[model samples]
Target: MSTEIIYQTLAILLGFAGLIWSADRFVASSASIAKNLGMSTMTIGLTIVSLGTSAPEVLVALSASLSDSGSLAMGNALGSNVANIALVLAITAIVAPIPIAKQLFKMEAPFLVGVTALLGLFIFNGELSRLEGLILLLLIPVFLWLVSRTQTGVEQEEIERSEGFKTFAWFIVSLAILIGSANTLVWGAKGVALTLGVSELLIGLTIVAVGTSLPELAASVASALKGHHDIALGNIIGSNIFNIIAVASIPGVVGPLAIDPDILSRDYYVMAGLTALLVIACALTLKRRGSKLGRSFGVVMLSSFCAYYYFLV
Candidate 1:
């Protein structure tokens, strides 16, 4: 490899590590602050934690867009959604079968589908306009409003004011790290793409997307292993939704982003198919009164993921 490629590879590795580590810390501190402020567990999980989990993608989108690589940002959003389900959720299901909560599925699935359809409509014309981006951003508050209504009955415990202040400080520090690391990651990714003579969209879809998705993979597996099945599935759903609306919108808001044909023809279809498969898999489990998604289904998901990657290559 050339000297530049070596340096770029190192940057990608270091940036990924920093991104993952700081993102975790940021989310933890944010959740602590929210809890200290008397937010319920469900509300925190749905709003703060969900957004926190998606921070990497959001920051990366901003970084890539600012760098004038808007197609890369769009690829990251779409490709991350594909990876979140096909790779992350697949691995998590295999770790331990995830149980589908009927209520959670019913409430969130429609919103996910709705947002996905909205994204499709916007992109069908081959470009995302600033107005469309703003429209997508406007839906965020509506999503939060719907989330607030489904408050769980869990009681909030009080925390010391000093502890809350400390968490807030951590939040700020980690957030700064997140921003820096995202820019670093984007720089490395663009470098690698240039060296490899691949399009920025390809790099974003393959390398950058999977790297940014590591947190989701880890979180889903841990949740599944710990028997927090709802959390495992919920995290994937929430992250995918954010990728579609929030992350994808950055390019449009920054400047008009032309849609890559492969994104619509390949990646988007794969993502939508996997999402439908998930809905079907969970829906089948719901018939058994929220039974678990079995190892067999997991194997199928893994197989599909492998097949998709093979097709990509």
Candidate 2:
């Protein structure tokens, strides 16, 4: 390969490493803060943990948008959501099956579907305008407020435990790493796409999306291993919501993004389908505690992801 290729490869590797480290630091800080505040683990998982893990996706999409690769930016957002459910959750389920909560089925899962449907509607016209972006951005604060208001006393205590000066410091450091790594990853992904004669959309759909989603993989796996199935489920669901409403919204808010209408007609619809499948799977598995996600479910998820990848490439 050429020197440019080598530099790009190195940048990609460094970016991945930075993302993992940042995620770890963010999780630790969040956990510590929660512990200090006597917050419930579930609350911590739902809020701080979810936000921290989803930071890389936000950063990556923002960088891609700013760099003028609208397709890649949107692809990363949508693709990451698909991967979070199909790949990350599948792998976690295979490793250690997570039990589903009834509340999740009734509330969060439906919310995910709603946000995804809204996303499809927003992009249906082939462009995400500044006004639409602002609307999406506005939803973040409302969501946060709702979470704060609805979280139980135990959850609040957990959040307080995790809150402290050190936690704030870690958050700052993680934010810096998230920004730097996103830039590096986008640059590297663009280089690779050019070198291989592939579209940036393919790179975003596969490499960039997968690299940034490592945080979700890590968080979910950790939760699964710890026998906190609810945490594992919550992480994936929360991240997907954030990916659509927050990460994907940033680009259009900063500036209008012109998208291929096919994304709505094709990819977005596929995403909705996959999300529905996830909800069904969760519902089916709700009655069993500590039960392994059967091989069939894993195979189905993996198969769906593979099919999506093939279509993208």
Candidate 3:
């Protein structure tokens, strides 16, 4: 192989490795903190666990934004959301079909769709201004507060336990791993993009997107394997919500991102369609009284993703 091919291969391998390691670290640390804090399984599934799993995507977007790779930054955020639903969830279903979270459909999924639509609207102005970014950033705290307000008494105890020294320690460790792994993946992605003569947008959409989404994949798969339908479904729904509002929002604030109008017009619409498809699937599955995502559903989701990939190429 040529030198460029070798570098590209190495970059892709290292990126994948860093992502997997970071994901494992995130799961371990999050689970430990949640356990120590006496958090309920549902609360953990919705908040702390979801945030931990999304840390890699958040870090990657922030790093890319700071580096002035606006397209890659935004693409990672949007592409990861797309992948989380179509790719990650599909794989998890194939491993062990995951059930839909009814509450998630009523609450978080709508919020996710709203945020995604808002993002598309905001970027239609060509660039996400600093003021817009600030607005998006402010929304994150508000969202957390809203989620907290809806928590049950049992969930409250879990949040309370999340406040001690051990919890803080786990948070710190998870944050460190998140940052370190993000840096490694970004560097490797850049190297690979250069060597392969591919745009960073493509890299972010495919390689980087998949890498940052590893945590979600791991979390969903684990939940499915354990037959915790709510946890499995909640994690995917929450992560998808965060990827759009939280992850995509950061780039808008860190710096102005000039979104390709074409992306907004085309890809963004495709993303919305995919989100709708997921919602429809969830509704149909629930109607059928099926707790597990069936093989046919998994195949449809996977095939949709494959078609999207082909369009990208």
Candidate that would win on TM-score: 2
Q: Stretches of candidate 2 above 4 Å error?
A: 16-28, 153-186, 288-295
Note each model's CA RMSD in angstroms. 3.6, 3.2, 3.8
Candidate 1 yields a Cα-based lDDT of 0.75
C-alpha-based local distance difference test score of model 2: 0.75
Best by lDDT: 1
Per-model TM-score on C-alpha atoms: 0.82, 0.84, 0.83
Error of model 3, residue 77, in angstroms? 0.8
Candidate 3: regions farther than 4 A off? 1-38, 153-186
Q: Which of the two, 1 or 2, has more lDDT?
A: 1
lDDT of 1 by residue, 147-264 (tens): 6665455444342333866898897787667656655765787788777687788888877787678667755665465444555676788788888889999999998889889988
After superposition, the stretches of candidate 1 with alpha carbons farther than 4 Å from their true spots are 15-42, 154-190
